[model samples]
Target: MKIGELARRTGLSASRIRFYEASGLIEARRLGNGYRDYPEDAVQRLEVITCGQQAGFSLEEMRALTLEPTGGANRHERLLASLKGKVVEIEAMQARLAQSRTHLLALIAGIEGKPVDISCEENAQRLLARLRENDEPHSQAT
Candidate 1:
């Protein structure tokens, strides 16, 4: 299929499909006119990638999770370890999210009650700091 057909079938923009190709998440061949010609399986791969993204896996992580190397005996053990670690991280994140929600509720109630020495700016800064501290994996990108 051509890029346009793939985009329509996937419900994703052509540019986004191209970007995914550039990111090494999708592969395509060049047609006679130099347009991208995607294989039939590309649509399925795109669907899987989209599903993984919705489930919070980065492209790199998704690639690792989808690896199909020739019969590695330790694959199950590695996947188990990765999933277990992710579960623990997710649990910790849930706790932090609950705490943040509680804190935000308190802040809202305090503001509604006309707290004397508190300002919205100060509260916002505090909340932002708490969020950054609790965010997973300490990204250097931001």
Candidate 2:
């Protein structure tokens, strides 16, 4: 089909499809009239490409997984390393979220008990320290 039809069917822009083609994430054949012809499968391929991107896979990573066998090159190692890094990142974020929740609860309790501003500040500092300590292990693991 034509580029416009492909874009409409895939819910992507024509330029985006063209860019994906140029980036080697997608392929198209040139017709005798110099227009690009795409298979019906191109839409599904583009969908997979975009979904992989949203899942934090880089173009090169997506290409390796979808386009060909990885052949046990550094690509596999790199993917593993990247996944480890993401795991560490997620753990750290969770630590921060827990800290924020703790701090918020403390603040609410202090307000309900009519505590002084200085007490709230001290409680907040303690919560922050706990968060830092919790995140330390994740950081060191990375």
On lDDT, the leading prediction is 2
Give residue 12's error in model 2 in angstroms.
Answer: 0.5
In model 1, the runs with Cα more than 4 Å from the true position are 70-84, 114-142
Residue 109's lDDT in candidate 2: 68
The per-residue C-alpha lDDT of model 2 at residue 123 equals 69
Cα lDDT tens digits for candidate 2, 1-142: 9999999999999999999999887789999999999999899889988887886678887786667654667767766776687678778989999988986786576456653555766766766675567557675777
Clashing pairs for predicted structure model 1, backbone only: none
| Candidate lDDT values, in order | 0.79, 0.80
What's the C-alpha lDDT at position 119 in model 1? 85
- Candidate with the greatest TM-score versus the true structure: 1
Model 2 vs. true fold: TM: 0.55
Q: List the residue pairs that clash in candidate 2.
A: none
